[model samples]
Target chain A: MDEDAKAVATALARESAADGLRRLTDLLLRVADDDPGLAAIAQELDRITEELDQITEELDQITEELDRITEELGASDDGRRPVGVDPVAGRANACAPPLEVWCLPDGTAGASGSLGITYQGPRGLVHGGVSALILDHVLNVALSEQGPAAAGGELSVRYHRPLPLYRNFLATGRLSRGADGELRAVGEITVAGVVAVSAARIVGGRGVRM
Target chain B: MDEDAKAVATALARESAADGLRRLTDLLLRVADDDPGLAAIAQELDRITEELDQITEELDQITEELDRITEELGASDDGRRPVGVDPVAGRANACAPPLEVWCLPDGTAGASGSLGITYQGPRGLVHGGVSALILDHVLNVALSEQGPAAAGGELSVRYHRPLPLYRNFLATGRLSRGADGELRAVGEITVAGVVAVSAARIVGGRGVRM
Candidate 1:
């Protein structure tokens, strides 16, 4: 498939807009630059923001309705209904670098995405928290369906080396049952085939590692 | 100060554009809506992408120069130079919720921000990894000057309860010296006066918690 089509298939929804959001993020990082092209973007954004402000003000009339609809969607009796936007791998979430996830034959979950300056942490590296975000999402995805409710557990992250920006990275995960009978999802972020950050999401009760 | 000026001052730089980027995010979440107003944003983004495509193509000319400048900025004898964008709290970083951080008289580091659907995690709540992101950034910020190099060690996060969206939350951190002489930054996320997540950043060598 074409790249556009692929992005469309990849994102859960609003792929064009989300891609645009990503580009906007990239451009904003250069805003401090003295470039005239960058200034044009600043002006364009002013117009867009003005337009959005007006629409949103009118949108306030339907605010209650939207909230009601959102509530109905989130109205799970079990209190675990997903809020639809996954901050790391969920395509629809603009906050996400939105990794593309797939599976290996052994059921290991795999995700791939290129880190940019937007995910920048200290200086040229991806944020430690961003790595945690990716691993947490990918491991949970790799876990069998048995562990959805176990998603909100403690995450232990060991930063072996700083993950860098503007590099394509792969994150892979597999589920293992701990000795204490709790399920654990373990994963790593690899740049150019080397592990940079390794993590494990311990589901439920702070159980021991597998 | 007025709200706009306050946002400007609170942000280290590029406050207007970052805030605009954020509003764009809020608008994108509602792209699923059939509202005529929402359609305008989609159309506007299409125009934006076209314009950006042109500018970025020109930007490719300076790509090397930008990279050179970025390299100069990132160039440090030691490998720990910060990349200048903080994903959770850095005002200049569009990816950040861009929390406002300040120091308490007692040397506690404090951060305040309201998360939105963009940072949404599992259904109807903040992403688990996001809490880790906030705590990680805040803790690193909180630790006294002794621990900058120790920032990337390890982060342990325990989710006491789900941190909700569209609500204001505060994360606070303080430095604690471990018995082994390693430093640890301890902090928590509190919403409406309730602790939803607690975290500790173990600075180096896998030191025990203080």
Candidate 2:
């Protein structure tokens, strides 16, 4: 199992043990007034309580480690905008993408984007629909270089992957081919560069802006 | 002007006239105590208000007539979906499309799609960005069908029309051509069958579900 899973499991075991000890203490207290072995039972109960204290400490350590792991996972896959580049073309200096995005230099009109808190979807995690919105934005903006134009005449995206909540992600869009008045663009949204969603669009001449 | 536009204009005029009368009433009230001579002026104001009322009533009647015209204009349109029907193969339903999609007896894709509330982009009217989203959705879906069966790959869409808000809209997607495991799609979004958004997509075979 993964480190996080292991930590979680350890924490659960320790907590359960602690709870069991507390239950034993409660049973001992309830019978102490009537049982002739009350004194012995009281001694055993003291030992169990001491053990529960140790278990509680161990569980606390595991919970802290699990929190760190969760943060690391979230940062690695959260998809909003990219890092080290301007989120907007000319306004990069003025507006950084709410998330981080990476601009690829492969001449394929490629860009990777990341998202963060301002773009929350689910209560604590990103919403699935918001993930699609981010993909659409990344793909549409990535095609801005084809002819100094930015807009979508058509777009189609499918949820091939489940976008998680509050996680770092990656989104990439590329211009595939172009001819006459038509151009083709494609993109993918990923978690830590793993494809979570795939999409495509057909764009034509600079028509009236919608 | 189109019927919808005309209706809008007439309604605006009537609203303006009513507002004018109300303003005049306030003006006369303010002047009543300041100058006895203003009583004469109030008579003139009354006459002007009566004239405005007449114009307002006439415009209201015209607006009602125009409303019918606008409804008719919005109801019928020339947009269709094209799916080749194979009578013996039971593939005729393939040609059926989303509601409001126009179709010819022949299986050729139409050039327009109607706009609806789901396409809203802004607060009240259809948002330009949302309009683009709709166009993209249609083109990408159409391209998916025309491209390789396993070609459910990445795609992109471009917006070429200003899809107006609060008006009946039409949209279309056309498969221009496909080659080398790559395919091209093109189409336009229209308002009342008038072009509002244009799009294109380049698709390939990879992650396509269909």
Candidate 3:
């Protein structure tokens, strides 16, 4: 296969692995009732610990093998994308909650996804930072499609309500063109028809590094 | 052992597992220069993918075992911290980057940590949302130490420069008391003596839910 095809396949495999890990993370956060006697719980815990240890050992071996491969490859840092396959926001990123976006005729964008316990914070609510991350990404997507890529200069977010986990959420971003060639955007995250979080930001003009 | 001790041990084990996964994630993002012959690279990638598949299968089994245990225990959802062991900020959480916090006598809080490729965004820079996450957590910690738990209401962040990944960074939060019983705080994230991000937020009072 060509280099590009190989790269794509590697990314896909990595993303799948990430998805598996994400699912495991969600399971880890789930709380079990105190109904089970301490002894029974302890036994289960012990079993789980043993399994985790085995997994860790396997991972260690993989890391060593990867290190050896790196040396054999005589790898040198290249300017080709500082973050080769970011674990977040990359279409193939496993760490990010799956988000699907649709562009509107007027140049705005809409995104929808469900965040699970892996993204939970503050009781049953989604982490405030996670909300910001999704909103920021969507806003940038809207801007990138319109004109030159820009970096976020300032972002202000208001939490109107808690964004719940394990439920579908919608996010939208709209770009406003400025006369002086500056770009600004506003984004909102809504859950069940309620606007949970709202963000507004100004983007520096072209040549700005994010 | 006792129930409390059992809980602690379980948390520790989960954290260790998370840590292992975190390391694997970092390794996944590190790109080897295109020095290795494509055949060699493909062979290694295939091996890694196979290992990942095995690990994922093990995780699936673990999850099933956990589910069975939960059912046998007659677990019911309780107010007992939905996320029994947070993989993000919990001391026992292995997924989170190591963060150390020191509380000052003057009511401010200081935090230090290094972000890795797992949190990379925007061309090797730390994710903007991650900066907000750590800052928000520190601010809440400062507030909680002073009084009751509060929730983030509004947050404003200005990105003066990109936050670099895989480097030591400093974060600090200071509280501003409001005579009317409101809580407000300001925080900053700095790298190499340069301020990269500054944030300020108003937190809801006693009854606030984040």
- Top candidate when judged by DockQ against the true structure: 3
Give the TM-score comparing model 2 with the true structure, all chains together. 0.31
Give one digit per residue, the lDDT tens place, for model 3 in B15-117.
Answer: 6777677667666666432344536677767778778877878878887877776565554333355333442465434345567766787778878989866
**Local distance difference test, per candidate?**
0.63, 0.39, 0.68
TM-score of chain A of each: 0.68, 0.43, 0.79
| lDDT top scorer | 3
Better of 2 and 3 by lDDT: 3
Off by over 4 Å in 1: A1-13, A31-84, A103-106, A208-210, B1-13, B31-84, B147-149, B207-210
Q: How do the residues A56-167 of candidate 1 rate in per-residue lDDT, one tens digit apiece?
A: 3433433444444445444322333222346776565567885687767675987897887688776677878888878777776776545445555678888888787778
**Which 10-residue window in model 2 chain B sums to the lowest lDDT?**
B86-95
Q: Candidate 2 residues A1-210, lDDT tens each?
A: 554553344334322322222222222112212233323344443443344334334434433443443343343222222111121221111112234444456534333445432222222333333444455556555676655644435565655545664466666778776444456667776778677777665555442222
Candidates arranged by DockQ, highest first = 3, 1, 2
Question: Which is the better candidate, 1 or 3, if ranked by TM-score?
Answer: 3
What TM-score does candidate 1 get on C-alpha atoms?
0.71
The true-versus-predicted C-alpha distance at residue B194 of model 1, in Å, is 2.1
lDDT of 3 at B85: 46
Per-residue lDDT value at A175 in model 1: 81
Q: Write the per-residue lDDT of candidate 1 for residues B123-146, one digit (tens) a residue.
A: 567888788888887777776455
First chain TM-score, candidate 1: 0.68
Candidate 1 chain A: 10-residue stretch with minimal lDDT: A75-84
